[model samples]
Target: MVRFGVIGTNWITESFIAAGRKVKDFELTAVYSRKLEKAEEFASKHKAVHTFTDIEQMAKSKEIDAAYIASPNALHAEQAKILMQHGVHVLCEKPLASNVAEVKDLIETAKQHDVLLMEAMKSTFLPNFQEVKKHLGKIGTVRRYVAQLCQYSSRYDAYRQGTILNAFNPELSNGATMDIGIYCLYPLAALFGKPKEIKASGTLLESGVDGQATITLTYEEMEAVVYYSKITSSTLPSEIQGEDATIMIDHIGHFEDVKIQYHDSTEKIISGPQDNDHRMFYEIEEFVNLIQSGKRESSINTHELALTVAEIMEKARIQFGLIYPADRLQ
Candidate 1:
């Protein structure tokens, strides 16, 4: 079994643990939190063998072969670095880091440590997404790509009541672009390479982060647009248009349903029915296989792809005049 430890005791972390349980070789070995009580409670609930109040302690303990990082956006790189330095493989949740520089450094650190490092982007690892990639040629010459996700935050109500939550706080590097937009951006980068030019516009909240943003990326013969928001909801499905047909994706983040519509008015479903709840299993399985195979990076969610997404986000932040505290860090 690939023994695992987890950092962060949040809903996302819980979901990851639940999915990891479905992987045959996965084992939750430890749980880490800043408070001992929280660590103990989480470890007990997850049946973890160990609990850690200090991250470095967990990293150095040799109790786990890998760690899943679900901490706040600002802490992803640092926590991942710590684990990697101690010869622990890291499956870090996306955007990977606050900026391109940190993403570069994290990749380098993993290389230096000769450990596996993967951005836990569950969407791309899903079978539906893989099917979408497989059927891209059915759409002929791609002319346009439009992807979007906009969900009203559960924490938005508190923010409106004059209470600043971490989701809207720039100090934690949280924002619509980083939290939600990456769902759209990462897939685009995966399907196509880096764009030739980018144009970004967004609404900045009073707390100095994007509430909603629309970015248009210009390629050689095609252009792509991505819209994301945390202050509202959108029912629109993302589309990849080409000369022969268009591929429609139900949810860019999860990629539940995918369809192809041809110019002749013919339609075809490209993806099979999937269990959305256990979708994270694919990524966990991939991470384990990478570790077992002695690979340092994911072939699908590659370091270059993560770096491209980071550079795109950095440019978008510049366009919005939004700067997180992490952006100022060395």
Candidate 2:
């Protein structure tokens, strides 16, 4: 059994634990929060065996074989580093760290400690995503790709009212690309590797964080257009256009419906959830498998993929004049 210690009692953390329970040999052993009351409360709700206000205490204990980190953007590296040092496997929430330097450091730390570390990129592990990869050749030589994820954030109205939450804060390394647009970049990188050229621009809010971004990446054989926005909602689906046919991804972030339309008047649809259905289950399954295999990283969520993502995101954010303290450290 992979006994788990959860960090952060937020909704995503709950989602992780809930989904993990459905897997065989999964156990919720501990929970850590900054407040003793909060940790205790979460433990009671989740039926965890223990609760600790100190993450160091929770991670160092033998109760949990792994730690699921759902903390804020800036805290991912620091918390994961400490846990890995104690030989605890870590399944950290996406956008693994605030910058490329931190991602490199964590990768090295996991290797040195001989423990598993995986990013919780749920979409990439889904069966639908696998199906997308399998049939890419059917569309003929890829020429152009467009991947978009845009949503009207529930917190945006509050930010507009001058209440800045962590979601829109530049110092915490949170913005459209970091929080939302990354869905496009990660999948693209996983499928096609790094682009030869990148050109990016953004619409910034009063607090110097990007509300929306448009990035164009040029590969050897194709160009990809990506749009990510938290300030507005998008009705258009993402597309991979080829000479003979086109593949349409209905939702880029958590895709449910992927469609192929051929020039010969034929259509095939590989179905997925139009919305979330056990979204975190796939990543949790991957994490558990990597830990059991004594591997330090996942083949699907490769360290190389994470490194490439950090590099591309940081470069694009810099181009938009969005600088965080982590960038300076890098």
What local lDDT does model 2 show for residue 169? 85
Q: What's the C-alpha lDDT at position 322 in model 2?
A: 87
Q: Please, what are the lDDT tens digits per residue for candidate 1 over residues 1-330?
A: 999999999999999999999998999999999999999999999899899988899999989999999999999989999999999999999879999889999999999999999998889898999999999988889999999999999899999999999999998898999999999999999999999999999999999889999999999879999999999998999999999999999999888889999888889998897769888899999999988888888899999999999999999988989988898886
Evaluated against the true structure, the overall lDDT of model 2 is 0.88
- C-alpha TM-scores of all predictions: 0.99, 0.97
lDDT of 2 at 214: 95
lDDT of each: 0.93, 0.88
**Residue 249 miss distance in model 1 (angstroms):** 0.8
RMSD after Cα superposition, model 2 = 1.4
Clashes of each: 0, 1
Clashing pairs in 1: none
Model 2: pairs clashing at backbone N, Cα or C within 3 Å: 256-272
Off by over 4 Å in 1: none
Superposed Cα deviation of residue 282, candidate 1 (Å):
0.4
